[model samples]
Target: MVVGDASLEIDTVVIGAGPGGYVAAIRAAQLGQSVLIVDKSEWGGVCLNRGCIPSKALISAAHQYETVQNASSMGITMENVKVDYSKVQEFKRGVVSKLTGGVAGLLKGNKVQMFKGEAMFINETEVRVFNDQEAPRYKFKNCIIATGSRPIELKPFPYGGRILSSTEALELPEIPKSLIVIGGGYIGAELSQMFAKFGTKVTIIEGADMVLPGFDKDLTQLVSKNMKKHGFEIFTKAQAQSATQTDKDVTVKFTVDGKEQEVTGDYLLVTVGRRPNTDGELGLDMIGVKMTDRGLIEVDHQGRTSIPHIYAIGDIVPGLALAHKASYEAKVAAEAIAGLPSVVDYKCIPAVCFTDPECSSVGYSEAEAKEKGYNVKVGKFAYVGNGRALSLNAPEGFVKIVADAETGLVLGGQIVGIEASNLISEVALAIENALTLEDIALTIHAHPTLGELVMEAAEVALGHPIHAIVR
Candidate 1:
């Protein structure tokens, strides 16, 4: 292992240390491949260091604070409810540190060599690991590229100072008096509502007609309604034009209904989207690997790239830029390298938005099923009719199940209410395993539980709902 040596060889090399990359590395190692996983950044990458985990931590803290502020409905009373902003950040960092440390331990326990540097392809079978002082060559029998993505920056609002990305917002020193969010996608909607819970005056400007565009409107409507009631000012069909930052505040100029308007806030958070980190020195073209114009690498069912032994997964490849999605692909890619018969399956990949009343969906939406030429029969049961939801004082949304009209097979499911994030997994399993409505309806879900909503939704789809009046 000489510093200047260019002859280090491994059975497999995984680039990036994110969820996808780390999982690929571990799985490949478990299958008896000598693996080396490298990343120039922190161990857990953006999701742990900045995106999902930290954002969720902040959201959880904000939710707790909001609960204390509004506990009168529960006949519980508290005085002088306050949030220590620094403590919240401390808690977030602690959570990240623990998980990242655990990941490192896993890699070490699995005997996966960890390297810290950037990787550029020398050829289909070779990658040069570069650092400030050394350039080491790592030759591999196989390589998996799991380099993720970064937050997309808009020219009109370059991220600096008051105009922040999610990464910066998660580490804000104090709760801003007001926040102007420029996108209403999952990241934007989730963070804006989280801040609103912490008493930040938040305004969201979205280019779409509704927030959480990836979700069905009926589901987003519940979130939109709750956000508005929580004092979030959202302007759909709005496009941000520019931002003027100052020492005290920032003024964001946007357009709505063909009229230009400005909103002043302490900070402006931009979460338009993310671009794959496939640019600048990765050398995909040098290895004759194919990628889209948008820089998303082309991969097959087993996450194999144009160069057969060279594989790609996660945000760098096509599909939803989700942590779970990348991890799923990671398993398939690693198994493929081990000569196992494994391929990626996205039929029941669940997407969850952890807002006030969490929303989750798996498999196809109602419209998606119909478009795919399935005669979809959809039925919904509201939380208002669920005993668990009423007991929890959260009866604001519904669970809808989509099934095949002829076969009664569960096609997909959507939930918009408390614990929706947790509840969607039952539906995901049903769809993934090709379970039918009767399979769920016959399952004895415990009475006075949130999970009954799934059973109830299934019953409604079967036209034999026992809880709610079938409409």
Candidate 2:
């Protein structure tokens, strides 16, 4: 330790104040541990500041713009409809700032000490925090690493000038007349659709057979269909080779179906994926914290590493790099550190994508259930058959549920339509609590609501659907 470097003793220390880190710090503090959290950047981390919140803010604006532009069907007409990209960026920034501020207040209210700095583990028991200059040496009884991740930059298309990462794409001073998005993952799809709705001629190049590859083909089809109607171009089975940029535009080269193709656009937004922040200055190796080959920390059920006292969560762990997943593990790790029986559970973790109609899923799908060796019964309810959907004039998606044929236990569910994100939670809860299709079907769902689609699908699974003619 450097001379004159004061030493502070802490019950728990959390690195990276993202959703996972801050939540763990707060939970540990609430559990009567003297918690201290160190973060390098803004309080809310990537999810709140750059990823989830800001993106959603822009998505909401795009939705509003679309709704207003297409209200002629509702006997509403408006002229001179236009989007101001600068104002949109301002709105997104405001949302990010407000939420980040709220997170700061929450940390303070929970009595968790906040340190704005970069932390590197000196060893299993000690960490040195630097904020331009080093802070006091912190000797912690236990530590949680939630450093999260950063966007990966392709070497062939390094982010600069006309090439943009998700972070840079979100902060574009003005919407480009044309944009090419590499990678058809949720981040790419969501931003592509957003820019399309904002009047950009958007093209998405996905290496997979379909965009949003993790989602079911049916869901991706619906999203792709909707995107196509907006004059968006999509290329599947495509490989991005390289990119060259000038002052005003970028030209991307790629190959598809044994043919080389090139596209020139005002900007190229690369949303390939994110890389974990476990390397470099994190110093997990020095502390004997084992990491997997992919650079993610190896942790057990309670988010504990090989080192009993140090734990990891979120993007640093081996599951989906989602904000909610991180927050969930954060609580579990904090509780486990406090001598509670809490352990990480991925059973009912829900994933929601804010596409045009939105997409959400929880637990296993029909294929997953079958792969797990369970005999399955599947029920699918289309939005076109639901009253609330028709009333909303958005009848273009479906709710599908999979259950055990013998036991009627709800195994998993998927949704593609309006409020899918909000609607998927009910099914997640049912699966988490081991509720069955009969339970969901028997429960009275209010009439003329989107949630009724879920109930209708459950009835179909039980072989007694009331709304639509059974197949």
Candidate 3:
């Protein structure tokens, strides 16, 4: 529609108004750049609308349900316990709406231009935004791609009513009487536990030898034990061949440890992994953008793609496919585009699994430290030894600290217990600051708090723990 060359000029253009795109746009605007953001779908993207926020709402509801069921032990008795799935869906929708609205307001408040359409590249310097009625084109000095990823669908089991992806699992009409989850990663483990707590007979089948593969084996063992304790079945070294759906049920066929087995359930969740959403008219190939074997765009530390002015961040790029990581990378890319030096420190990113008793880790694991040729010393303090944990009736897990023996520096930290997700932030901060084990041990932690477990673990590393008997 615009014939004049002056109409297309923009200082910075961002595609896909998810967490990364919106944040980048806002930061660029704040830095006094004329910014424009374009998105094909909702502004908040998958994480705000479907992935992180919605899933956490479901998990929170499930936890409350479990709490009600156990109220008798807390000197409280209830006549009956029940869950209204529709109300849960309403609550999740309300949350997504509020956050998405806030994002829109934020963009407007920052004076960033917003476009609602799919963006495709016409050339290295030009991008075309296609809307239903008309196609508008804009040329920018710099562009950032924040197109996120989608749930990976297994070839053996296509997504349907019986065979569901994580998205569909978040919107269950009713909790299935029995559920089978394929994939032993964090997604599978967390969702399986949530459903089990909601009274669904849950089972997990993983091709790997353990659930939460790539995690510290000890932590994985604790997760497995907790699942078993909650009456969930877990099968490792198992590969699902196919799933057959019928009117009454769905039967999953898999081989476990060279033994053929079949499990039937009301639903099957496919959470093997997620793939980048890089296709759909983006014109990436025309711009000479290099992509990995998995179709993820290759970007530098500052999020610049092969094309000098074009950058990519979030799930469209690499590293951990988490929302917060995306946001951090967006800032770096924005700052770099504004002719400022910005670098993303990948080592400080934290990963958390929101199971009943959460699991979280940051930086190097003990095995990773050893593989890197470091003389690692580990210290572990169980929740059973923590007064707060015992009072809360969730003393099943422990915190493990891995540090350099020579320098007493904290290399990594892992925790598997209640509120472990929030607890891992301190470890991340310590790792980012290069804090030593001795430093953490010397710091005084408040009494009757779960956080004291971190200090206790550091004390154990120093061979002098107060709460538990030192061996």
lDDT against the true structure, per candidate, is 0.92, 0.92, 0.89
lDDT of 1: 0.92
- Looking at model 3, residue 40 earns an lDDT score of 79
Between candidates 1 and 2, name the one with more favorable lDDT: 2
Q: For residues 378-442, what per-residue lDDT tens digits would candidate 1 score against the true structure?
A: 87999999888998889899999999999999999999999999999999999888999999999
- In lDDT terms, which candidate is top? 2
lDDT of 3 by residue, 193-274 (tens): 8888888898899888899987778777887887898888888888899889998789999998778899999999999999
Supply candidate 1's per-residue lDDT for 451: 95
> Which residue pairs show collisions in model 3?
none
**Span of ten consecutive residues with least summed lDDT in model 3:** 1-10
> Which portions of model 1 miss their true places by more than 4 Å?
none
TM-score, prediction 2: 0.98
Per-residue CA lDDT of model 2 for 1-471, tens digit only, reads 346866789999999899999999999999999999999899989999889999999999999999999899888999999888888889999999899999999999999988898898887899988787656689999999999999998899888899999999888888789999999999999999999998899888889999999999998899999999999889999999999899989999999998999999999999999999999887887877888898999999999999999999999889899999999999999999999999887999999999988999999999999999999999899999998898888999999999999999999999999999999999998998999998998888898799999999998888898887786
Error of 1 at 105 (Å): 0.7
